[model samples]
Target: MFKIMIVEDDPKIREIVLENITKWGFDGLGVEDFSEVFNTFIKYEPHLILMDINLPSFDGFYWCNKIREVSKVPIIFVSSRNTNMDIIMAVNMGGDDFIQKPFSLEVLMAKMNAILRRTYSYTSVESNIIEHNGAALNLKDSTIIYNEHKLELTKNEFKIIYLLMKNNGGVVSRDKIMRSLWEDESFVDDNTLTVNINRLRKKLADIGLDNFIQTKKGQGYIIL
Candidate 1:
């Protein structure tokens, strides 16, 4: 089933939306730890998201920008803020659509269905091997081949490597990385990500790819 992640903070709205969406026959995931909205998203691997504008620590715009960094998951902003500027900014910040609060259930369901169809209706299957800089990632086999060396990878490892390699020479921030690793559950603590990344790097080192992924200090990580 195609999953949809909802990031609304208000429990009433969150519950209502979840009920409405599920009643429409699509699976829906409610964000538990508001702090790890993106993290939950990566784990759920949702096909779309329903985001609220005002959040506890960060606004939906900030989260939307973060999600756009590594994914094109369809985001539909759902907020009580109904200014034209708010809607415009939502769109500019990578929201695919915006639904104002006090909206009809039918309208919300319609928008959800439309966005899902539009996003996935045209997605083609990825090729087994994606290559660059003499490196090849076999999607079918979950391995990275480079310089006649084959580096085996777990699914998460392959995805992390795929994202970094795809955005070669560019820093992929921890927020983005954590989203990829644990988008399904509660917040992914910083130390948790640190541990996984360290483990992933050691695995790469085992396969002779020492320092293939570099730390970016106050920023994120990169494949340099």
Candidate 2:
């Protein structure tokens, strides 16, 4: 089942939305700690987010931008602020849609369904970017951007990082990586894999992402 996370601060609204989401046959999560919104997002990895503009600690826009740094998950701004500028800013901040406050639950569900369908229906449509921990790897260009600095990757480097980032937060065994490389027609022995991994780590460190990929001894590598 698709999981939807609600980031609204209002208890009443959050409760109502959660109830409706359950009725709509989707799993729902509500954020209780506004201070740890981003961390919560990382842990839940929800398919969609419902964010309110006026949130504690940080506004919705701030959290949205932060989340966008590491994910392309669809976000919808549900707020009382209805200015044209608000709508424009919402779109600019990577929100898929904006819903004014006091919205009908039915309409909210409809918009959510539409976005979910468009985003998840086509298996062939892959996002050209994969992001984690403030770094974005561009699949189209074989480059990684972090802290406003961009660095190009060699073919092997790109393939390794791509595989790791695609499985971020999970251990990718050495054997699995080698098999992937073999399937790509670039056969590499164990020693070569170590060299490539070291090189990639150096490049990532140069871009200020030190220890981005962690070694799970007796297991393999992982990007957390």
Top TM-score prediction, candidate number: 2
Which lDDT values do the candidates have, in the order given? 0.79, 0.88
Clashing pairs in 2: none
Worst 10 residues of 1 by lDDT: 124-133
Candidate 2 lDDT at 122 equals 82
Model 1: per-residue Cα lDDT over 1-224, one tens digit each: 67778998999988988988787777988886877775565456678889999998889999898667546778999999999999999999999998888888889888988887887788842334555555566666687755445677887788788888878689998888778888753565679877777888997777667888899899999986
Q: Write the residue-wise lDDT of candidate 2 on 53-149 in tens digits.
A: 9999899999999878657889999999999999999999999999999999999999999999999998433456677876778787798877657
Record all residue pairs in model 1 with backbone atoms less than 3 Å apart, i.e. clashing.
39-183, 40-183, 41-183, 42-183, 43-183, 43-184, 44-184
TM-scores for all candidates: the values are 0.59, 0.67
- The clash count of every prediction, one per candidate, is 7, 0
Error of 1 at 131 (Å): 20
